[model samples]
Target: MDWEEHAARLADEVTDRVSRWREPVAAVPRHELVPRWWQQVAGEWVLRDGPCDLEAWLAAAYCDTSLVTSIGALHADHALGDEKPTGLPTSSATLPSLVVRFLRHARLTQGLDLLDLGTGAGGLAAYAAQRLGSRHVTSVDVDPYLTDAAAGRLARMGLYPQFFAMDATRAIPGTYDRIIATVALEPGRGLVPVLRALRPGGRLVTTLANTSLILTAWKAENGGAVGQVERDWAGFMKTRHSTDYTPGPDALLAHARQAEGDEVTAGRYPVLDVSAAWELRSMLEVTTPGVELHYEENGRRRTACLVHTDGSWARATAEWLAPPEVHQGGPRRLWNELERIRNRLNAEGQLPLYGSRLEITPDGVCHLSRGKWTASLGV
Candidate 1:
């Protein structure tokens, strides 16, 4: 297979958006990094083996889209052809564009020591190692299998960078000049180890869990960092402590779908898929953390559900764009909070989440403010 040609074409495509990363994008062989991946087919995760179908492999590898390499605890590399695991994606080679965006946000420079957290398929680490000599780059991931696989793949391509298998939420090995986390970090305690590993005056770029907001901050003399919520948005899998994430709220969602709620009323607005609406999702996360949102459509009817650990649950059903029938149960009215956010959006035309000033203390607490709006995340 003419992988160099494919790589060159991919470089041409991505460099149009991130011109500075042209060389690294062209040099690294993304297909080699993600030899096997999982593709969801008809609501099932079907394995895709790159070597088995070169045409499909090249098409997917060179595209500006993420490729899932692991689902739940099953890595595509080890799955049988007949196996179709049902679980969340545990690892992936993030699209080339987002990796560039992260590096650009970090303001990378030669000779700077960099830490690449959440080294899923090692695409980001490979690109960074190629741009800045491998000696200056270190990649870390919680899954030892991922680190081992990525390290071997990178070495085969004549690129070598330090790799470590450790949970990023816990203690990291050493301090660095820059840290770029491709994983979504829980705003609270998860930020502690990462901040501790950042040298004074160093920069950090990452996304908060359950939100699409990108945070870019520079470490301060006071041990905290100060910057702003970037206007750009990106979502990543939250950092995991084990081989797979704890069971999701499937049982709670099933309950929300059928139970008679404490309150039921006609909603003012039509049912909206909160997960697909990035701005609204981020705002809702800021207003009420730990809310798991699920949306479904059957023929012309649509349903949106929200469940929280606090036992608050909301379900809305509607046809097309018609106003929804809303039901709420538990101490807090979850749907009301969502409508309040929507009303603010309709009234103000935009949200204060993007471009908000951000401050991170040594303990990992985040203070975000924009105009009269202010919110704190983390313990």
Candidate 2:
């Protein structure tokens, strides 16, 4: 089938997922946004030039999945033929369904001013410009090249939204009635600048870095925002601090794997895969930010590892459904803490992580409370 046919089918798929955003999904050409993307092939991040490979491009573009447009600062446009870029994804055209969900949460009206933060591939901004007039939309990104390219692409489709290449985490270019951030923001620091840029009583839809929490809140009279974590889960690339992707703590992972921990004990439950539990993972991230997790399943043996920047580490191993041996090191017993949180969940049947009450202060500190559990993000 042709590109138009693929686009139409993709629109139908997205509409099936979300009927409210049918028109925008049908109208916007997602292929234009992801003319070239990165795909993991053979354990390597290889560049896929869509224009050169129309069939492959059509298949990936129309599918409901993210297309990585940039690796580190290496935009797919600059990548050589067959080049395999390394590092975590810096930017991508988010999946169509997720984009529609965010737009739905924004509660856009006919002529409300909208700020599209993190215009990677400009898909969301293009859709918004199509739904609402381009005059009412503005798109911004940290990368100047991405902004310039997205503006050009949007113009080709008659979308002329104002495009700015600036840090969305810092002072924005203008105030808006609504702001949708595709870029994941650091937990506490996300709210302040977004609230500052939002007009009084305006709404903001965004996600926190290192967690899958789609947060929606409205600007309040006190320069803060009040919101609740949506029941839905979503993830996006974290806001970058440098031109290249910042390397994670690989050095620590090595040590955490081999070093004899300060404390060792038998886990109350079988080795658990924390990543498989959304509520548990999100809650742990809120309470202990920047903790990295790894889990492996080998035959009947299940092993889990947790590493934190504070020199804390935990390892658990056991057979399926059997009590596991846990080793914890450093100042905090990471595994023990996880077990405590897990025990609470097993008893209460849920963690106070999703749909929890969130109160953000003017300085961007967020206090989350649900039932008897409370945690501060900016601490």
Give the winner by lDDT.
Answer: 1
lDDT of 1 by residue, 151-194 (tens): 99999989899999998898899999999999999987899999
Assess each prediction's global lDDT (C-alpha) against the native: 0.93, 0.84
Candidate of highest TM-score: 1
Cα RMSD of all models vs. native, in order, equals: 1.1, 2.2
Question: Stretches of candidate 2 above 4 Å error?
Answer: 16-20, 296-303, 318-322
lDDT of candidate 1? 0.93
Q: Considering summed lDDT, which 10 consecutive residues are worst modelled in model 2?
A: 238-247
- TM-scores for the candidates: 0.98, 0.92
Model 2, position 70, has a per-residue lDDT of 87
Q: In candidate 2, what are the lDDT values of residues 32-136, reduced to their tens digit? A: 888888888866898888888788888988898999888887999889987777777888999998898899899999879999988888999988998898999
